[model samples]
Target: MAKRRLGGGLICGLLLAGSVLAAPPTAVIIGTPPQPDWTQLTPAQKSALAPLSKDWDSMESVRKKKWLGIAERYPKMKADEQNRMQERMREWARLTPEQRAKVRDSYKDFNQLPAEQKQTVKEKWKAYLSLPAAERQRLREAGKSVQLLTPPQPEPQVDESLAPAIVGESPASPGAVPQ
Candidate 1:
């Protein structure tokens, strides 16, 4: 019995020593790059991502990496492409987190469509854009009414710049409502 107790104590002591000598748990995630704070970005990265400066530090590591990749490519893009990217970034930065999540979900859904279905969707979008502004507004209002049975939520404040980019009609234009 004494020998058994000594053996048990020795095993316990080894385990305790092993645990004590082990490295402390790290806050760092494996397989993902370190998310750099905004101040850590280089001048060119800052310039390329100026629109997102306010939200950069709050962004997820994956998102930061994606944007950093875009910034790296920004200098090589054509002038027109660069301008469009900047405009889109500004619009994206203006979106609330829920809106951004919705956009991401929609994008994923769209990408999962078969090639033919994707083409059909693109065509349908074009057709919708071709409709008269008043008709579009009427359609939008009708769609809203269809959702009346659902619980009401506060409306997201629409940015005027986002209006034209989404519906091909400037907010200043007659019958142009930001959806």
Candidate 2:
């Protein structure tokens, strides 16, 4: 009986240990970070994100988080890359909501293109960018002119009096002629 009791207790202990080992780990709860006041920004972050200052407080949390992430990375970027980012931010700030939406849609569509097609587009853009400023401006002006020239309209409605002469047929009736 003593040996049996010891075996039972050992089995119970084994079962309890197994159950404890199988239990899930405790969840680690991470609290959302509070939004930073404009004054709280580092000088470098403030300079990098100057274009967005006016609307920063009203920005959604996700957007704020993204901007903050970018700001944190800015100091580490090469000079040219940082300048390009600043230029892009300025341009983005200037865009209207509709224009921004169009850009986002265009970016999504571009990203969905096959790799070969994307490469071709990237090559074409690189070629365009390589052109001189004056040449680019001239190309833009030429495109504007092409767009401004409207396509020819369909033939105008024929006057009933003139229809007889053109069609070689008399008007069906006096009522047929428009006022």
Candidate 3:
């Protein structure tokens, strides 16, 4: 069979959907650096990209482009987290083409949700997760929107300005002399 194709948008959407289903972390954690290129990857790493490898020859362009984005934002993750990610990658490789297609479709549906409805669903889910199943079902019957919790952003800090010249050293100062 001819190799299957996956669009960049679909791939990104799938990753986003996967992130949404991920369990909330009690503490924030850094993620691992992705293998920058196939050549940089180990045999096990190649295994992680398996079923997709038949298409890999044609897919390298997409892989390189996506991996570069990952590399730039990548942080050094704790070892245990790295191991878990590797396992996930292995399982991701095992997904059948049809399963992948279904995931992509689900992602498309999620993306189509209205912003307000999405927020309501998100709140509802959080509230539901905290309640008994009967209470959650009641809330579910009420029906609300849902959206994924956004990944955390780093806090901003003020930019440090260069030290200004001392009063006597600079031409801009009132008392400084010109040559």
Candidate 4:
């Protein structure tokens, strides 16, 4: 009878442990975070909050909270810094989920590029934008002929697998000649 009682106690102890393990976390691991009250933020967070109102009800709780925190803290930040942060928040709201994921994945690569490369890309884009509509159309039409005139790229016999890692970068550097 003592052995049976001990076995029953052990089973109850195990059941209790399982329940404890299954209990909800005191600290949330994921999902949306909490948003502070909108009234709590200072002037900058208030400004940031202004553009957010339209979408606030639909935003993830964490993001909503993050914006509220921004409002709370932004009063101490410089005007320029606050404005830039606000712009980023605004842009974040504008992107679709797929676009946001793509940007999230490639953002590190974009951030890693040097200033000169960034400038080069900007200059090329500006030039492309500045060209007249007719000229742009002409260039697109010419591209087909240009491709036809180009010689076939012969595969090199060199075993790149056996070759040393080339220290050089790709030809597509943002600021490099947009060839």
lDDT of each: 0.84, 0.77, 0.56, 0.67
Residue-by-residue lDDT tens digits, candidate 3, 30-149: 555343445655565454454445444444454545534533333465667656655665665677768767877867865777777567657755765887878666655666312233
lDDT of 3: 0.56
Candidate 3 TM-score to native? 0.34
RMSD list, candidates in order: 17.7, 14.9, 26.5, 12.5
Candidate 3 ranges beyond 4 A from true positions: 1-37, 40-60, 71-75, 119-179
Q: What TM-score do all the candidates reach, one by one?
A: 0.59, 0.55, 0.34, 0.40
lDDT of 2 by residue, 1-179 (tens): 99999999999999999998896988998755777878888888899899988877776666778888999999999999999998988888888879878888878977877777677667766776687989777877778422322233346898766966575554665335444
Q: Local error of candidate 4 at 106, Å? A: 3.0
- What is the per-residue lDDT of model 1 for residues 1-179, given as tens digits with 9 covering 90 to 100? 99999999999999999999999998965756778999999999999999999999999898999999999999999999999999999999999999999889878977877777677667667777787999778877889422322223447888876866666676577567655
Considering every candidate listed, which one attains the maximal lDDT?
A: 1
Candidate 4 Cα RMSD (Å): 12.5
lDDT, residue 8, model 1: 100
Task: Name model 1 segments beyond 4 Å from true.
Answer: 1-31, 130-179
Better of 1 and 4 by lDDT: 1
Q: Model 3 has how many clashing residue pairs?
A: 5
Query: Which lDDT tens digits does candidate 4 get at residues 68-139?
Result: 777777778898988887788788778887987887766675566677665655666577668788877787
